[model samples]
Target: MSTFQRFRESWLRPILFFGNNLLSLIGGALTSASAFVLIGFYLVDAFGHGGSRNPYLGIILGFFLPALFLLGLLLIPLGILARHAALRRAGKIPSVYPRINLADPLFRHGIEVVLLATFVNFVLLGTATYRGVAYMDTKDFCGATCHVMAPEGTAYPVFAHSGVPCVGCHVGSGVGGYIHAKVNGTRQLIDVLRNRYPAPILTNDLLPSASQTCLNCHRADAWIGDKIRISTTFDDDEKNTRTRSLILLHVGGRDLTGKLSGIHGAHLGHIVYISTDTRHQIIHYVAKTEADGSVVEYTDTNLKQARVGVQRAMDCTDCHNRVAHSFDTPEKAVDRSMLAGAISPELPFIHKESIALLKASYGSPEQARTQIAASLKRFYQSNYPDLWQKDQPRIAEAASRLAVLWSQNVFPFMKVTWGTYPNNLGHNDYPGCSRCHDGSHNSASGQSISSDCSVCHNVLTIDDSNRSQLADLGVQ
Candidate 1:
């Protein structure tokens, strides 16, 4: 009976139903996936803004999403059509089925089938095109596609809000800004692909919108009081000399409107600070702006620019740059390893040995670590046998800690070794606090970061050139 009944329906009929329904299901899924992807992206954009001035990722995403939705919208109709065809073959003719004939003697039936599938094909093609364009526009894809960004990109995870996308901060508000960023981003991609990219490139560019972009959040009306910066160092000797330097805080805030300028203006709600390279490339600018139209810019350049206009812009990141994800500073790197008891501070030349091992260098980090250990062992065994035995354990720990510190701070790939990525928040590398504090810059105002540390901050003691002299003041 089964065989007799099956004889009435050709194998081709079932194949037709299966093919039709499968295509229909896939088409519907494609449409739904597009919606889901868009929603998911919107959610990610909303919560992922950190260190971002434009806070409008949602806006841009919303704007671009419509185009993608159109593509999905197109896909839905094709899916509907496929489902109608399948139902008709199942003997459940859809109310609006196109009378397609598979039993035709000529090629008419095949032509109709081709036409039907073509509609679905076109929709899928559109979806693919939209996805391709969208992916290219994403900051993650833009900043992360190349191997060159690996070292720097790795830094982004710990910077600002961990979830913030790269575009949030780099690309700000408006269609004008959007267009500029697109053009710039494409050019950067080309640079990476062609290897025409410059080394030590600045992440932030000129025409920074400290005036517009930053002032939205930080206002200039909330600044007051003197700032104090104090630092201490530990010597292996019984006496851990503490050096103190205190500065009266100088910060400005915005007017009724949230507008602030420079670090001097906004301690809290005032403005942002940014920094640039010597040529004025805003390498890693940091700071916020206030509603009253004030801004604080602290550039990596630290005002070492030999020129202007061509000078770089600074961002809040320049100093408070490492706010959340702090890597090891050279001294701090030593201190961490020493404190952890990882290295042998007891080893002869423990400090000196750590320095040398760090300096010796290797092609790879693993190589560096291995060589550092060997170098220390050889140095101690060859020179100070007694100290090596006593301090070997501490020294070993120090070596490991140094290796980790080097791993975090030293980027040998970009020709950045220890002390290579110099911190210019203040002026050690390029005039730092001195740039503003120098009597020359303040000649008009009669204010300066004088040679006398006491002017800006009460210096309790001096560590460099003269370590023994204490200010006699409580800090000294």
Candidate 2:
């Protein structure tokens, strides 16, 4: 017999017989279709240029299609095995033993065909595995798949490190980090499926070590020098008088001599503290190690019990905890809008009105949007009738912008609103720098953590609208 004829009879006939069964047939069809679809998506994502990032592609290719493919692959073998058992019980074949002879043309042909099919199946499996893993690492898969992560999803894009992937910080480089993330992700997935996840999404368990994650991008020894920061605040008066505070931030880092100075240099890898609360808001004890290898421990004077709970080393995250996903306060949001020209600063009491609308409580996002716009429109029409008539479009535009700001920062479903996640970057907003350096923590030898403002930054000008300091430095 010809090689092709013998191969078809021995190999193709048996495969068709097993796979043609109802369950096996369905599984085979599904697996083939899903494999093709996933490959197509992978190709487009890999090669496409100048096209917008397609988040849904990651969902379909990384998660849904791979799951379907795996299910089908598993079903195929189970169906074939069941069919063999049923056939044996029915006495269609005397025994399940195969009549084999290596030298025979039929046997050789069957072996050849089996090897070929196996190779093809392995190739497809490899492709699917690669695509599945790659998809899971994407920002869309992490932030968009779970409704509980909506707050993070909304804030990430507007954050300073928006371009950086979620895994870059959450799951650092190396096999161990990847495995840890996957295991943790599985638990989170189970919680989501069972609806057992906590509201506001506590981040204590999700935090990765700063040395492994944050330090990967930010070098400790890199010179940061000083940063000039200008903050604008508006009064509630009719003129909405603008005032600017200019400060020279001493963000010094370690020099070649290994001398630690400034905010980051002073704290990074040197300070350890104990917090009684989960949020780390109430620090009870602090221990500082000097360059001479001497350790000085400080206890909070107010707290009767000093060593209350967990003692943790201070890291980058302690201060920059909300760096990637920070929500703005009502006042800050209004200030930003005016500065960006989204809301007219010329409008009388616009700052006060916008802040009031933002602070007001509402049941739903839709309600907030509608009410904010309505409230602003009513205020301008009733209080400043002439201004409202003259610049009706400006008022409406400002109201719409305010609504957008509210939606971006607040998520009613997740129980997140303005200031829900405290940004620990500054003292004025939250008990950030003051958590450890509030002057209340004193060592046994009488050394206290200095709460002096000059230690970290120098105030160039305080609430001066003239911006004299900026002008002198040739800055607008």
Best by TM-score: 2
lDDT of 1 by residue, 52-84 (tens): 233244323433454454555565556656665
Please give the RMSD to the true structure for each candidate, in Å: 12.0, 4.3
lDDT of 2 by residue, 170-204 (tens): 99568988898999988987898899887888775
Candidate 2: Cα lDDT at 161: 90
What global local distance difference test value does model 1 have? Answer: 0.52
Best by lDDT: 2
Which parts of model 1 have CA positions greater than 4 angstroms off? 1-145, 157-163, 204-207, 211-230, 234-263, 266-329, 336-348, 383-393, 442-476
> Candidate 2: where is the Cα deviation over 4 Å?
1-30, 36-57, 79-118, 465-470, 474-476
Backbone clashes in model 2, listed as residue pairs = none
Model 2: lDDT of residue 296 = 91
Clashes of each: 72, 0
Q: Once model 2 is optimally superposed onto the true structure by TM-score, how far is the C-alpha of residue 361 displaced, in angstroms?
A: 2.4
